[model samples]
Target chain A: MMNRKILLHSRPQGLPTEDTFKFEEAPIQEPEEGQVLVKSIYLSVDPYMRGRMNDSKSYVPPYPLGEVITGGVVGEVIESRSDQFSKGDKVLGMLGWQLYNVADADKLQQVDENIAPLSAYLSVIGMTGLTAYFGLMDIGRPKAGETVVVSGAAGAVGSIVGQIAKIQGAHVVGIAGSDEKTDWLTKELGFDAAINYKTTPNMKEALEKACPNGVDIYFDNVGGDISDAVMTQLNDYARIPLCGAISSYNQEEGSDVGPRILTKLIKTRSMIKGFVLGDYADRLPEGAKMLGQWLAEGKLRYEETILEGFDRVPEAFLELFQGTNIGKMLVKVESTE
Target chain B: MMNRKILLHSRPQGLPTEDTFKFEEAPIQEPEEGQVLVKSIYLSVDPYMRGRMNDSKSYVPPYPLGEVITGGVVGEVIESRSDQFSKGDKVLGMLGWQLYNVADADKLQQVDENIAPLSAYLSVIGMTGLTAYFGLMDIGRPKAGETVVVSGAAGAVGSIVGQIAKIQGAHVVGIAGSDEKTDWLTKELGFDAAINYKTTPNMKEALEKACPNGVDIYFDNVGGDISDAVMTQLNDYARIPLCGAISSYNQEEGSDVGPRILTKLIKTRSMIKGFVLGDYADRLPEGAKMLGQWLAEGKLRYEETILEGFDRVPEAFLELFQGTNIGKMLVKVESTE
Candidate 1:
């Protein structure tokens, strides 16, 4: 049989383009001892991938050139040579963007599609869910009646965070790019309020009207001017969980200048903490358990923006920068049945 | 008795000038049923008071126009109407910039001059020492072998933070404005390294050379460009205890813009927290116990730039912005023989 894969062709100067990815084909390999030959079902494309394309030191190393792009993938074990994974089992792992993957059974975690769909593992119950869980619960520590303002409120992680904050009894406010997103957050997700950044001329005034008691916690995903606006409204002892800065990801380094935060920070006595899900690697089971319980109890809800076909992976990844996807952006590869 | 006090005549557009103060003389106040007549021996003029000069809201309300500026004062109780205070007792309280103050005995904290000196209560054993202790211990949480970088290293709180970090066996580096201050930090206070920021052309390069292990904790006292440089060298999981931003204290609001820290903060997974000593008001006794033990053990030392005479109060306060004082700046109002 034949397998198709995608590789990092070259690093883009600004926003990544079509030339950044290269297509390839190879003969499918058989599963070795203690391994499984898995057929890819769905792959995730996230904002953090932009940081890896650069040749700089971070929490994780930068991606190497001419290599299969590594990301979260949900697949089916077509052939298993290990006792851990049986044939036809659904599994999830940090695997490459390929049609088929031959990986060690130990590297893949068996996921159940019985509770939710196969794409749900890559969205609501996987890394995306865990990222929102730890960042908000551990860092934010929302109190009942306290105001929580989340940037990228309609996006995957932010959507989960707002729902969890609501479960904790916090008055949640969302900031998104479109009126549709704001309406969905307020009407469907039960957010206390929502602000459309594209339509609103003055966010500070809108925030003042929305958060009458002042912002107690800010879950930052799209940083820059949006973050600068939120910083001005922080109440005393406000907590900020810094997850991503997708707005400035394409701006390059040293040029993302804004108002210095030290003054307002000192004045309000606020704290802003930058974190990734990897920071809570040891507590993954705890987070996953809570997320599962919440989902089963119907206390939590999630959204997904899936693209069909493996070839549309690069296009789906590019759409993240344009704010075209509302939730977890996933690309479906093939059918297992 | 004639009492001399200064009033905030007018709010300066930027930095306070000679025209800001108005001197007046009134009869010394008599102690009421719950009050004590105290003679002010020494008064403190700190950088934090500058924030109060503006009409903006902060931790405390802005200093009222045409009113006496309140600050730390050490005085002698000449007359007592309350059972709490006795004659010849030394007490400390937040009192006006005046020679005599008639205050309620409940507001004054008794100090033992025999343990240290009269000025020591206003410096090491008073709010200055407590601010350093809590900001470093509670927020910074320095571990042994960690590299700690302190800006405004020779000032009141910065000097104390360095000594405390040294007691924890951390490698401490200080950034100050002059050779005299830097020499005092390294030669006297036992700092591992010190940088004269005014003479150093590139603070980032100097910091890199001084901190080869990268900065684990940054105790920021001076903000603006100096803080921007410190932000670049933070190691993974770095903790910054934001104490003060004396660099831009004189500049009016909204113009102190610099590089945004979100990207670097996310990359390094660091946390920066701004705090005031009031945040630990409930634990003042706990901090006082630790500071008193360190001082009695000879593990800590202090510096005070004492300007003689009550008339020099405003001059001493103005000198704070000029960076003329190496440590705690004080004005001697009177001597009790």
Candidate 2:
């Protein structure tokens, strides 16, 4: 059978265009010893992947040109050469933008479809969930009645973060790019307040009015003007968990020089911490159990915007920068049926 | 008796000039109930006092226009009406910029002239030393053999910070504006290396050479381009204790927008914590005992740049911006003998 894959054609200086990616077809390779041939069901497209596109120093290495762009993928184990996995078993692993992949058996996590849908493994119970769990609970450490502001509040990681902060009894305020996203955050996700940053003429004033008691913890996903506004209202000993700076991910390097917000940190005796999900790899099991329990109890809610067909993967990724996705952005690599 | 006081004549638009302060003489009042008549001996001229000069919100309130500017002062009690203090007792308290004043006895800390010098009460064993100890130990949290960088390394708080980091078993690197200060840091204070930021053609390169191992802890007393340089060399999980930002203290309020260094912080998974010594007031005795023991064991060294007269207090305060002092800067308000 033929396998279709997408490759990085060239690195973009700023916002990636249609020409930045290339699609090609090849014959599917057979699984070797201790490996499994998997058919991709769902592929995740996230903002963090933008960092790996740059040929510079970052937490993750740059994606090599002329190779299949890799990310979180949920697939069905159609052919297995190992004793650990059986045919027809659904699994989750870091695969690629391809219709099928030959993955190492050890690297794939078996997904129990009866427990939850296969796409849940790519989101709320996976990387995004664990990130929100550790960063907010550990770094943000929001206390009861304290105001917690989450930027990119309607996005995957932030939507979960606001809910978790609410679970911890914090007064959750969210900042999203659109009114619809903000409404969803407040109405559906249980956020106490949500600001449409795009519609607001004065963000600082809007933030001040929303967080009347001042912000105690800031879960920053978009780190430009929104962060600057949040910073102006931080109370003494406030904590800022720097998860992502999606605002500048597509901009040319050095184009965005944010205001000198560090002074506010000094004045208020606050703390700003930058962290990634991989840092808490050891605690993933515990985090997954807690998140799973929360989901099972209906205490958490999630949404996914899935694009149909394998060829739409690049378009789904581009939509992330456009603020077009309501929640987790995913590409359906193949039909489950 | 007569009292000669320094008053805040006008609020400084940018940097304080001769017009910013006014000297006047007033009648010395009697010590009523629960009060003492004190003769100021040594008054501290600290960088933090600059914040108090502006009519803005801060940890300390702004110096009232047409009123005496107040700060940490060590003095001798000439008269007392309270049981807590007696006549001729040496005391340390937050007194005004005056030669003689009536201060509340309960607010004064009795200083023992026999243990260390009276000026030490305003410095090494007092505010400056405590600031260094807590900010470095609690916030910086340098582990053994890790590289620690202290900016404004020649000044009051920065000098003590570098020494404390060394005592904590870290490889200390000092960044000072002058070569003389750098020499003092490396040659006398036992610093592993010192950078003369002024003469260094490329500060980032110089820092890289000085700290071969990436900086694990940064004791930031000066924030500006110097701090920007230090940030680039931070190791993963690096900790920065934000103390003072002397570089921009004198600049026009809106002119100094520091580079968005927070991005580097995210990339490194580092933390920057801003704190004041008052936060650790309850733990002062423990910190003082350790500092005193270190000083007695000759493990700690200190320097004091004492300006001779009370009238030189403003000049001494201005010298902080000029980077003149080698260590603790103080104004001798009255002679001890």
Candidate 3:
């Protein structure tokens, strides 16, 4: 048997291109003790991956040159050498871009597909869900009647955040790259208002108008000018959960400078916090339980943009930068059965 | 009786000048049914006052043109009508830059001078003390063995913050403008190390050397280049209590841009919160009790640069901008006797 994988060809200078990744094929190996041979079903391609492509110090280390890029992957265990995993068991874990992964059984989390779709495990019921949960509840702490403006609102993490804020009785406003995304957020996700950042030349004014009352909680995923606009509309004692700065993740160091926010912070007596999902690893089960309950109760809705075939992985990853994905961007390598 | 007062003659453009203030004399009035005639003994000239001189929206409204600038003042109730105040009682309240104030007795906090010195009510045991206590304990939340770096370490609030962090058993490092201030922080206040920001050519390197372990909490008072240097040395999950931005108070709008801190916050999963002392008004007694205990136990010491005479109020206020004051800068308007 053969295993096809994607490798980090080179570190990106600015935005990543096709040349940044390299394709490889290797002989499938047998699972050693406490290991499983898993066939990849779905692969998550997120904006945070852009940071891993750069050769700089960050919360997580950069992807090494000529190494298989590893990320959140949902797979089916075809063969297991450990009692923790079994044949035909669906699982989720950090695995390489390869179609077939020989991973430690202990690292693989068994997934029950009957609860929700397999892709949801890599998204709404997975890391993205937990990211929104902790970043909002733990940091943002949205109170009833508070206005929450979510940047990158149509994305996986953001869409969940908006829904969570709404569930918490907050007035939700979303900012997205396209009118389609804006429509989906406002019409489908029940967002109070949605600002299409691409069409809105005056984002600050648009946000100010959307949030008649100043923004109390700003869920920042797309930083840069979007964050600058949001900063201007923050209310007194506003909380900003800085989930990601995807806008500047692809840019070179020191090239992107946000507006002087300290003055605004002082004026409003606000708080800005930056965090990652992995930081709340210990409490992820709690977040997942809550998200699952919300999903089962139909209080939380999710969307996904799926690309078929393993070769489309790089294309799917690149689409994130172009703002093509409405929710979670996932690439299907093989059928679950 | 004739009352000598200082008025905001003109708004400052870049830095405040002597011409910005106008001295006046007014006839002292008798106490009304609910008011008391308090003779100002000590007047606090804080850096936050610089923001009040500008015509802009902030936590507090700007100082009105040609009006007596009001601030935290320690006074003695010479005459009273309301039972809340008594003759010869030491009090603390928001009073104008004048010799005598006929203020409502209900608004005054009758401070016991026996607990500490009368001026200590204006410095370590009053608003300044409360600012450090809440900002550090509530926002910064410095744990034992953590490294706490305080900017404007020689100022009214910063000096107390360093001492409080010490009481919490943290490795305290201070950043101040002058070598004298740095020496006082380390030699007098028990700071682990001190960085003379004004003289240090490479502040980031100097800070790195001072804080061998990365900074866990940054009590920011002077928030310009000094803050930028501190941000570079911040450890993961660092907390920054944004107390004041004295460095930018004098500069014109858009002239003061600190380095992009959002990226740093993201990299370290850090947080920055701006707050005022009034936010914790109800909890003042709790902090006061703790501070008083520390003062009594000799764990906390306070210093003040007293500019004698009411006419020196403007000069004393200007001294803050020049970084001349070692600790709390005050104008002794009248002798305690």
Candidate 4:
């Protein structure tokens, strides 16, 4: 059978263009011992992928040219040569950008679709969910009645961060790129206030109006001027979880306006801590179980911006940088059945 | 008896000048019911005092114009009306920039001059020592064989920080403002290496040469480009204790250079924590007891830049911002005898 795959033709210099990737087809390889052939059902298009496309040292190595673009994928095991995975079982693994992947069965986690939608496993109940869970609870440590401000609040990881802060009885404020996403955050996600960063002329003033008590916990996803504005309103002993800097991820070179709040941090006696979801991989099951329980109780709500068809994965990934995705950005490769 | 005091005559716009202060004399007041009249012997000139001179909101209230500049002082009780203190007893308290102070006896800590020198009570065996000890141990948490880099490495606080890191079995690097201070750090303080920032063309390269493995714990006393350079060399899970930002303390307005290395912090998955000695005031006794033992055993060495007379306190403070003082800056008001 022909297996279609998206390959990294060249590393991106700045923002990635469609030309950076190439679509190619290959013969489906038979699953060797302790391996399963996964039919890609849903693929995650995330902001962190931008870092992997750069030829620089990072937490993980950069993607090599001519290799399949690496990413998280939720799929079904169509064929298996190992006792670990069974045929027709739903699984989530790092299967990259491909229609069919011969993956090690040990790397895949069996998923129960009855608990939630299959796509949710690649988002809210997956890496994005765990990223928000550990980054907020372990680092931010939002206290009851404390004010929490989240950047990229309408995006996948941020949406969950706001909801989790709200569930913990915190006054949550969200900063998003559009008015529509802002309304959804406040009206549906139970956020106290939402600042549409695109329309907001003065973010510092907006934050002041929304959080009068000053931000006690800041879950930073977009680290540029938005972070600087939020930092000025931070209360004494504030905890900041530096999850991602989506604002600067696409830039080829460093900006003149870097994170300008270090002196303010010293003055307020606040803390800024950086973290990644993979760092806490050992505790993923613990985070997933808690998130699963919260989802069943309807205490946590998530939104997904799905782009239909495997051919449109690059377009979906591009839309993430443009802030076009309302929630977790995902691309559908094939039907679950 | 005539009591002399150094008062803040005018608010400093930038760097404090001689005209910023006024020396005045008045008749010494009698001790009230719960008070004791103490004669000042050694006065501490700290960087935090510069913050108190500005008319702005801070952790501590700004010192009013024409008021005695606030600071910690080691004194001897000349007259006592309270049971808490007795005549001829040496004590340490916030007696400000004055030759005599009528303060509540309960506010003073009795000191044994025989344990160490009386002046050491205001420095190495006192606040500066405790600031370095707790700020490094509690916040930095350096592990054995890890690398530690300290800014203002020859200053009162930073000097102690490098030594303490060495005691904890970490390879310590000191960044100072002069060649003399750098030599003192490496030869006298037992630092592995010392960088004279004034002579060094590139701080990042100097840091790279000193710490080949990258910095694990950074004790920041002077914040600005030095801090920015040190931050770039921080390893994963590095801890930074933001003790003081002496570089920016004298500036009336904020600098244009925002913390340019904050993005590096996220990439490195490090932590920057701001701390004040006052926050850990309750635990002072614990740190003091330990530091006292270290001093008595000759495990820790200290240097003092003693400026003669109470009138030299303002000049001594100005020297701190100019990076002229080596180790702790003190104003010797009178002989203990």
Q: B1-337 in candidate 1: lDDT tens per residue?
A: 6998888888877778988888889989898999998899999999999999889979989889898889999999999999999999999999999989999999999998888798888888888889999999999999999999999899999999999999999999999989999999999999999999899999899999999999999999989999999999999999999999998888877788999999999999999999999999999999889888999999998999999888889999999988889879888885333
DockQ score for model 1: 0.87
What is the Cα-based lDDT of residue B100 in candidate 4?
94
A best-first ranking of the candidates according to their TM-score comes to: 1, 4, 3, 2
Pairwise DockQ winner, candidates 1 and 4: 1
Better of 3 and 4 by lDDT: 3
Tens digits of lDDT, candidate 1, A81-173: 999988999999999999999999999999887888888888778888899999999999999999999999989899999999999999999
lDDT of 2 by residue, B1-337 (tens): 6899999999887778999999999999899999999999999999988888888767778889999999999999999999998888999999999999898888999999999999998888999999999999999887889999999888878888888888889999999988899999999999999999889999989989999998999999988888888988999899999998888787655466655766677888999999999999899998899889998899888899999788898899888888888889999975445
Provide per-model DockQ scores. 0.87, 0.64, 0.64, 0.63
Off-target runs (Cα >4 Å) in candidate 4 are A335-337, B335-337
Clashing pairs in 1: none
Candidate 1: where are CA atoms >4 Å away? A335-337, B335-337
The pairs that clash in candidate 2 are none
Candidate 3 residue lDDT tens string, A207-304: 87899999999999988888888998888999999998888877776667656778779878999999999889899889999999999999999999
Instruction: Estimate the TM-score for candidate 1.
Output: 0.98
| Model 1 chain A poorest 10 in a row by lDDT | A328-337
Off by over 4 Å in 3: A335-337, B335-337
Q: Which ten residues in a row have the lowest lDDT in candidate 3 chain B?
A: B252-261
The CAPRI quality class of candidate 1 comes to: high
lDDT of 3: 0.91
DockQ of 4: 0.63
